[model samples]
Target: MTGRFVLQNVKTINGIAVDIILENGKIIEIVPPGTGIGDKIIDYKQKVFVSSGWIDLHVHAFPELDPYGDDVDEIGYKTGVTTVIDAGSTGADQISDLVSSYKNSKTNVFAFLNISRIGLKRIDELSDTSWLDEKELKKAISQYGDFIVGLKARISKSVVGPNGIEPLKIARKFSADTGLPLMVHIGSGPPDIREVLNLLEQQDIITHYLNGKANNLFDEKGEPLPEFNKAIERGVHLDVGHGTASFSFPTAEVAKKRDIRFNTISTDIYRGNRLNGPVYSMANVLTKFLYLGYPLKEVIDAVTVNAAVWLRKPELGRISVGDIGNLTLFSIEDESTLLQDSEGEKRMAEKRVVVKGVVINGEFNEC
Candidate 1:
């Protein structure tokens, strides 16, 4: 049966309170606190905040694939995130397996079909250009276009091997053919980042934008690089893919201080990072951004409306009448908290972002 619920006085990061009513997996109505009508309801009483359902754009949760991957629920509904897009965890050849498995999951799962046919079955999926079979790619995308929301290419020294920029260039051609928004993973670069950034047009996403490495957005003196700024000005989007080795606290802090904002905030959550150090969940990554000085509304927007806009999936993010009833109920707790980045640098913040409950497919679940 479709579950129904009413929540009142759910607090926000900005101290505003909202009341929501969810029915049949869509938001039926939104009214002021204590104004909604329903039974079997929980009067939150101004203790939590409600935002659109959270979307994790970059995660590796194809459990049967690799050790780097994790369970969907561990990084999805269990952590208050309603939607998770497995970033290049599978290629065209294996998407059917993933989609079939995820159909039974409670979390809303999506995928970014990797440029390489084998996906991340090996860390060096892009090492051989032979695996980037254009014919097979088009076939897979055509067959599973619904599940493959976008395409991904990891153009880094380790992943791309001797192919350098050739893999990305090939992926670009495939993106042009399929007309999917390409998500480029920037890491220690063998191919110059300037070339990579220049090739990206508007709507293309650069994940892991704040890596502390010299090859990333920050300059040697910690200033935002001119090339990076130009890329941003060209309407390219920046996403925080806080993976096991990607995020750097100092880099994020410097970017935040200069008002270099992210278009979307995503945790590249998986088994290793989720259970070990660095990224524990999507909330943990969002809290790190909070520590980096992003305002409450901005943080909410990044995961909600902003992400939906970038993904071109208007139905996924937002709380409004007739929209998918995906809502994240959370709180801003004032307390001392210690947060760490991938680099092991630590900082203390007085406020933490906490999850109370989430409204998913019109059903309420505790976080």
Candidate 2:
């Protein structure tokens, strides 16, 4: 794993063939196929499509919590995702432990620190007002400035309990004080979807925006709610945090027909969903988007450049020379694949996106 290496004869998502040369964990050159030489060559022979490494913005990678936890690497590089954002699986009380736990993993990890100090220790983290300790949250963010990307507040009825919109008010204050955006999870709501959307400002994220819950962003006739449109106009980002009960094919199809789209695609992956039914892997989720009629490039961009731009880390999204060499090697096969949504609806896709390997920090690992 030393010296220089060349990933030879790989096609970009747009179908241009190139040879990428890597040295010292950085991309050194990108040239036409057959024009690059290196100490070691791992040739894909133009069969593989390469893009900037995949990044999943929402995942439960804590690995200790029941039902909602998983090992970081298990859902990371092993599945062609070089980076994963643990979406509020930990808060101030356990943020340090979550950081330490992923130190040796091959996948790059970041987190959306839960506004509740207790985090997902209980499913109803924001149920108790005492758990929303601003002092402790500030301390955690100060300690892990680089690791904590934004604040996460699950504004659903079950998560917020009797608190209603109170927790989100506190989260808004925290976001203002901490200078970080919010990644709010929306679902069954008594605070009302409009109340939650109104509280979010520019650059904040609304994960699981396409869920088919009774309190979803669309109306009975599948039209986008006015609040949803306003939020988008305000620059609030939409993320497809397709979890066990979030994604709905009908909802997604309507969104596509209506021209509403995702800013990023993520799997709210955990032990239960990853192993048993929906939300299997990043690739599976991407395939679902492809089946929804999104072009291959758009589907891949949702997990790559679009996500990277939202995170403000452009290096993680493009295959340019001089950037760190992190890329996903996959192929779209001309075969029928069964795609299932969280609501148990199914669609047979004519093509499936399959991961072959990844170049992580200039080193190759097969998926």
Candidate 3:
């Protein structure tokens, strides 16, 4: 087995041109034009855009489970994403099965240990106290700590169903005990937003940051809630989970104006949300940020470096030498497109990009 490949004539997000060389499943060199020869050469002819393989910090393509669907690896390759974090798609009781049957057999997968016992199946049965057993949660974590990167709890009123913050508190305790981060799903909760944010510490994640009218980040007065700032001050990370009902445009506009930055960009790619709003591809999310006045470089960073940092997987999300030889090749197009948010608001993007190819561990495959 030879681990030698060459990527030629691609432009970085910054528009600086370079050639990338991958060998032995690692990036061995990045040189100017005419530096190396290889058995395989991908000449994009300046049409292909190169960036660190996109990382969707959130997704729910649980193939082993019927509810979440089975097209995760295909979706990632098609969308130019090399790695994904399955956000609570499986619960503590079902995680090992999901990991073995779905994650280990296919593409790169990191999961959030669901606070629920049954995971994403049987939505009607998911709730506070009834489905959550912290002891089982700890056992699951202990059993699959390598693949289970963090804790996940949906602290929404509708989801919790009168349990209040008890489930969330339990999740936090488990997270603290396990020494992993907590990824909280915020929206549709009765408790004050500030109080919820106060409980999370630095490196913890607050997903669905742009949801509105559900007692989310903004208050009744439409001002940036103080707890939001406090959480950021405490190093709590914000993520655009972008589910079917999250990512309101008005709130996103506010977030842009307030200069609130995202720690990562992820598609909550589940069965229910893939065809609805925001779409599944991380590149399209980058397009949305571009429409919101984010430069291409910044958008790329959010999906790559930012997400890798959040997961503490330094090997991923970069094209540097000695890094994982993963890359996403895409084409930027100037097209008029209507983008929809959580609230069904439409915004048009002047330019958008599409994934062309993906290289995973030095194997170049078209998306």
Roughly what TM-score does model 3 have, to 2 decimal places? Answer: 0.94
Specify the poorest-scoring 10-residue window by lDDT in model 2: 1-10
Candidate 1, run of 10 with poorest lDDT:
1-10
**What CA RMSD would you report for each candidate?**
1.5, 0.9, 2.0
**Model 1 lDDT per residue over 1-367, tens place:** 2566788778655677767777777778778788877765788888888887899889998998667788898888878999999999989788888888787788988889999999988989999988999898889888888788889999899999888899988988988998998999998878888878878878899999988876887777777778888888989999999998889988887888888889999999889889986899888888887887777888888988888887788878766799877878888889888989988989998888888888777778888
Error of 1 at 254 (Å): 1.7
Predicted structure with the largest lDDT when compared to the true one: 2
Q: Per model, how many backbone clashes are there?
A: 3, 0, 2
User: For candidate 3, lDDT tens digit of each residue in 1-367?
Assistant: 1368778888888887788888877888888855657777778877888988888888887776665655677557656888888888888878877777653433577889888888878652236476777788888877888898888888777777767777778778877788988898888766557668979998899999877666878766667789888889999998998877788888888888888878787778765556554565677677888899877788888888898888888768667888867788998798998888867788988898788888876678877
**Model 2 agreement with the true structure over 48-130: per-residue lDDT tens digits:** 99999999999999988897899998999999999999999999999999999998898989999999998999999999999
Index of the highest-TM-score prediction: 2
Clashing pairs in 2: none
lDDT of each: 0.85, 0.93, 0.79
In order of appearance, the predictions have TM-scores of 0.96, 0.98, 0.94
Candidates 2 and 3 compared by TM-score, better number: 2
